[model samples]
Target: MASADDVQRLFLQALVSRRVVTKSLARILLKKCVEAVKAAKEDLDIRIPDNDDSVNTFVINLNASLDKLDLEIVPFVDGLTGNQVYVLANRKGDEVAQVASDYSPAELAYFKVLAEMIITAPNSSYCLSSMAALRETQSLKATFTKTHGERVLDTFVARGWLYKSKSGRYSLTTRSTVELQTYITNTFPNDILHCTVCHEMVFRGIRCYTRNCEGVLHNHCYAAYKRARQTCPVCDTPWNGDSEGKLKKVGEGAFVEGQDKHARARRRVDDEDEDEDETPKQEEAPSRLRHRRRGRGKLRPKGR
Candidate 1:
């Protein structure tokens, strides 16, 4: 019987042989295998295990050998939903069989069980269900929130893994999809509406209305135009007539009859008081004017 050390040595030798496997390579291989398993599960609407038991055992043992390695192995016979295992096994029988043929009996058995478990019980407790759903870039943020309950969507935006459209939908960039897989897997957020000119969050803006035209200029950019030139710099559409630019006022009709009546009454009382005060002043002014005229007439006559 092979000792644990012997098994570990042989496994390492196989991995580092002509290929000279590095940690990165191992991660890539694991990712590919996981992806393949996920794909098979999705194609058949079930989980299928990797068919090489030897490989599975080696991976398990290899993970044990390295303190830093935290590999998760979904046991073929355990933790799967009944439907997942059944569907996976039924669809991937040939592939599993072929993989079993290439490996040792122990490895073959391990992989065969993995394949069966994946097919028969994909969502079972024993297996890690692959992310089978293909998420759109726009919906990633919301989905990410729903799935992980974390606010990692901002990180994606910060890293440019996601971009906002003028219409407020989030879409993934090509580089974003490639570099932010881990973040995406956690959760993606809805796309934000960013001003194309300023790259700032664009709420309802004048320049971002047309779906075909994603031109999102900042309010400052729009203000740069003269009154006659108040049109979209991108499309030359009039900003005044743009539906997005129309500001919707909230709670506009807050002042009703009672408030208006009170205000009108107070103004009326003030006007009446002012009129009363003015009448007395006007009467006094006439009398004073008559007296001043008489005095001036007397002085002038005497001088003449």
Candidate 2:
């Protein structure tokens, strides 16, 4: 048993905390609505409104009521099928427009490539290797370079805009995910292309962010592509291509027999630097240590 007041309170809680009903978040709210009713002893006017769609309608109605107060429920995007989510944001703020104006042209273009990579990444990985970014940089050859790209990437890594894996792959961080979701969805409305794997009409899918390859695969097909071949089937350009190529060479349309399983599975050694240090120290005498020992001899005379 739940009251109108209790249902209203739950709506307020949702808007306060999450602000948006992402697919996964929608389930959580639906569960909460149902559970709250069962826990309440007094019945006023509500029980967990049947299902997610119903719950969503309830939320929308609540937002609609706030129209008297200048607040509204807005969908993040239009024309994409399936469950539509409504997010709460103030009309006065206009955050997305303000943020877009803040970026320089180069940085703005970077996000476009990033958004494309995110949609096309296997498992919605939202990650791209540095080598891929370099290709984007090269396209801006008049304004950017490989050195400049690495600096920009490292800066992003430091600023929490991106996560830098030890092997040098860069992925959008949670902060970037939060800030750019609406922007990416709204901006790339027309970059539609086909999935190389299934050869289906894809609104959005995985794009192998290679310099020349730029192969696109359906979201589902990306995993199959990896399992079948680490390299892009069409271009044979590798993911993290600069580092590994035993399986296929760049610009070749053929598969090399053996692929590096670890890189393909992304089971990279996070402690590569530590392991390298230990190996070299164990295998070779420490010249630095010998230098320190020799330099310490002058210090003994002061004690004497």
Candidate 3:
């Protein structure tokens, strides 16, 4: 049964011990200590009034005043001590203490295990077996079963850290890949098609269609000499059994003499057939009967 004066004395002693007795800081610390005492008294089954609007308002103002005071104090401390100033510094001591007070020992251990799994997982892609193996290596009792693993994975998925592909394989996102690449370069190199003969990047090549003659040539070089002459560049045989003569560029009327003679002969035969088709058929009239009458007169004389 400590009196309020004893409590106030102890609170002032704590502030003096910590060397934090600035006016605004003292007010904020006293308010926090009063709240802590209230919580402790309530733990002893003591009933306090449910409403304390004045205290709540005072706490809100105290927090704002403390923030401004910290902002003013940090620069002075940094300038005097040569310490770097960090803007918006995380003063999470109270938050961490509150969370720690709320968590049981078993719950804290489970949370640690969950955090370790998240950190050690490859690209944060994991399974029950992997977490079990990790725990076994650390000599910790694994409290997670397959269902628990599924729940952990589901949480990561909901947070967009993990994804399941159509093939049922779990994978990390592109953002994760960029983060992991900082540790090591993970890429494979490859080569494009290069001509074996010329040792150049083969943009286009001519393949010999002849069996057992796997000849490849650059398009420009093959056309300039070997192809323009209408010969197999490798074998020197006339392509399509045509004479070893230069091929006329397409749209150029440069037929060979032999080809022209054969074409002209064909055209002459066609013209003769057309003439015969155009000729009309002639009809002969019957000979007059004068010869027959002379024969009849001579026969009449013989009869007389």
Worst 10 residues of 3 by lDDT: 295-304
lDDT of 1 by residue, 75-153 (tens): 2211111111100011112344345333333332222222222212211111111221111112222223223312333
Runs of candidate 1 exceeding 4 Å displacement: 1-190, 203-207, 225-228, 241-304
Candidates in order, TM-scores: namely 0.18, 0.35, 0.19
The pairs that clash in candidate 2 are: 120-205, 120-206, 120-207
The 0-to-1 C-alpha lDDT of every candidate, in the order given, reads 0.32, 0.48, 0.34
- Against the true structure, candidate 1 reaches a TM-score of 0.18
- Tally clashing residue pairs in candidate 3: 0
Q: Write the per-residue lDDT of candidate 3 for residues 1-304, one digit (tens) a residue.
A: 5333333444434543442133344445556666666665544432222334443343344346456433111211111112222112222223343353333433334433433232223311221233332232232244545555555545444533334444333333222222222221211001112333453322233445455553444444454455456656555556545442332211011112233234234434543544453333344222322211111110000000
**lDDT, candidate 2, 1-304, per-residue tens:** 4556565667567754655466456656756765675578444445555566776676677777777654555554211222345556444324444353444556545554444454444433434566665666754424876787677666566654566666555654433433444443344333334457655334324555556564776545664567767777677676544633333211112212222222233212322332344324544557533322221110000000
**Model 2 vs. true fold: TM:** 0.35
Considering every candidate listed, which one attains the maximal lDDT?
2
1 or 3, greater by TM-score: 3
